[model samples]
Target: MSSRLSSRRTRAGAVLSAALVLGSMLVGTALSTQASAAPAPDVGIAATTFADEFNGPAGTPVDGSKWNHEIGDNVNNHERQYSTNRTSNASLDGQGNLVITARRENPGNYNCWYGRCEYTSARLNTIGKFSQTYGRFETRLKMSHGQGMWPAFWMMGTTGGTWPNNGEIDIMENVGFEPNTVHGTIHGPGYSGSGGIGAAYTGPRFADGFHTFTLDWSPNLLIWYVDGQEYQRRTPADLGGRTWVFNDRPFFIILNLAVGGYWPGDPNASTPFPNNLTVDYVRVTNTPGGGGGGGGQITGLAGKCVDVAGASNANGTPVQIYDCNGSNAQRWTRSGNQLQALGKCLDAAGGGTANGTLVQLWDCNGSGAQQWAISGANDIVNIQANKCLDVTGNNSANGTRLQIWECTGGANQKWNAAV
Candidate 1:
């Protein structure tokens, strides 16, 4: 995301306390054999497309063929750490883990264009060596805890496009100030940087042990989970006027531990040194299980577009017939049993099963109200209602409301996808 964070300023003190508490707790756990509450990633070995268990000897460098180090200072988030390729900053810990250590270092150790640098860390990416179009991306790791610590598991498009325009998927990001919370975000033109579309997950302090951060990505959706518990989902409809640039494009992964910056602020005297982001493993898989389909225009009834009236993303937005304008409001994606537009599912209002039931936009759930299927006759039918998607009163004029009606083989009941 972007560098600015005016609101985070007030949360700085709380973050410091959390950092200290988390560090203490983690040290205790590491010293004992007691089981941790943190959960490891459920990496289906049979479905793995890529995996790194970091099983080399302690201090061994990362596999050059699988990753590249992003060396720099302040990078894009105005971070205070300089990322280097030093094994001291990133290496196998001998215990089947990749340890990315952040330390207080003098500017003499590393050249910096922003004057003296007091911190050093590591940033690794899979830009040229590995990239994926859609699948599951996950990592098991214990985050570093400190006032200025910033650790992330994210991805960027590998198409050599500019920031935002190319696309950025933050699978999981945590600022030391919020050690108990992790964020999942998507950055694209018109909705990038600090303005990226996303949400946060808050629970146990993940630094105490290892926890899994995962992204179930498809052509039209991104579902985030922490230790297998779903927390957030994002789609093109969430971007408002922005373009959805994630479809069918390859994205490479990145792992980094940064110190200081605008979001978490600079480290203070109370901040701990040698903070480490310990990763148990990183994995990728290609089994697209939660319904996969290309997002595109949906047409029916005289070739009119199935549109979101007023381009509204709000719940209960009317699903109407309109001239095809190729707007996001007309863009639809199929996720599981639901037909989604504007991040909501098309629903037969009130779960109405009879004819003349109005169709509207509703929050996506696995409910039968949102379930639909294409009939052999090419009708868009609501499965639960057993009725066809039809233009109200058979009127093809723009702005006509859509409804569910008994199958009548009318032209209005027939649908097509110009996907």
Candidate 2:
């Protein structure tokens, strides 16, 4: 969600600034749109961690335990709406749906970024109520329509960090101007705002009926689906050396109907008021392996373990392959895109990208040099460098230091990450 305030208009041929605000921090807002219409892959279900069916009597507010109303005019998005906590803006339809209405009236006569508020809507989030790291999050909903209307189902990291750096997953976002297109995007460091990596699925008008939007998230993969059809996927490799922050932390869900922002522009004379964003349900289920936050031995060439030299937590300590003695240094933990042992991250020395750059243990500073992805080919890849974690010289010596080298599909590059 480009929930940032910006006066720069880009609806024509101009460019939107990359310094738009999301929450209280600045971020970019350009989406690299990829189009796809593939069928959704068969996915197995697991234990559900969260679910909201939106069941209640008509006109009643949502369950307070499940959602928090984020009130106030969102100046960050340069929106014309004042998000209210009243049930009049958000209520159950008695038929198993939560409706968020955006009206032209502002009963409070609230002031906005552009003087008087022109609209009133509702924004709800599950920040403290629930959060998950890696899972399949899905929602079935019907979007609001008309120029200037923006409806979204998205997630934001709970790291309490600045925008983009904490990461964001846009499961579904629709602007009324393009009734048949919905976007799925990921915003993070070096790739926020107008530079966000995303894709658009264009088909039937989303505001005409209900559709299921989904995000299947794992350690290094995120796939988007609309109504059981796959549209786009993202991985660390797609970030172009940027930090992949999605795997390291838990994220909470957000639902809102925004009115008139940089992306959707202002409402037109023909635009409809009191448009509704109706949601039937939202659910989250655990994916296999559960993505990040796992710990175990990372075994590799000659059946040796990836070990931190001397089990030291000191920064810049060489990381090497050692005999499988089951020592603390051999115990590796996956935290987001990082591999840690003895409280230090496995890092590409000095953020190096050239082959032969030594691998070492460093302070976890959320750098791309410390980010790694274990691929399906059993290759442990350095995300920033796009290189494989190779055992130096293909030697299995107890003290053979590891290095980042071009992926050669050799046994020296293969790894069995128990993390």
* Candidate achieving the largest lDDT: 2
lDDT of 2 by residue, 299-332 (tens): 8889999998887766667788998887777766
lDDT per residue for candidate 1 within 1-419, as digits (tens), equals: 34544211110100000111111111221221212222211211124567786887999999998988987775446677778889989999987789999999964466554667778898898867888989878777988997888899998886646776778899999988898999998887777767778899998898987776778787788888765456788788787757999988898898989887778887888878889999977878774432332246778867899998898865567888899987768877544345666545688776767666677876544457777876555677777766677777667889887777666677777788532
Q: Give TM per candidate.
A: 0.60, 0.60
Candidate 1, residue 342: Cα displacement in angstroms equals: 30
Worst 10 residues of 2 by lDDT: 11-20
Model 1 off-target regions past 4 Å? 4-45, 289-419
True-vs-predicted CA distance for residue 3, candidate 1, Å: 2.5
Question: Residue 278 in model 1: shift from native, Å?
Answer: 0.2
Clashes of each: 1, 14
Angstrom error at residue 96, model 1: 0.4
As a TM-score, model 2 comes out at 0.60
Clashing pairs in 1: 2-193
List the global CA lDDT of all models: 0.72, 0.76
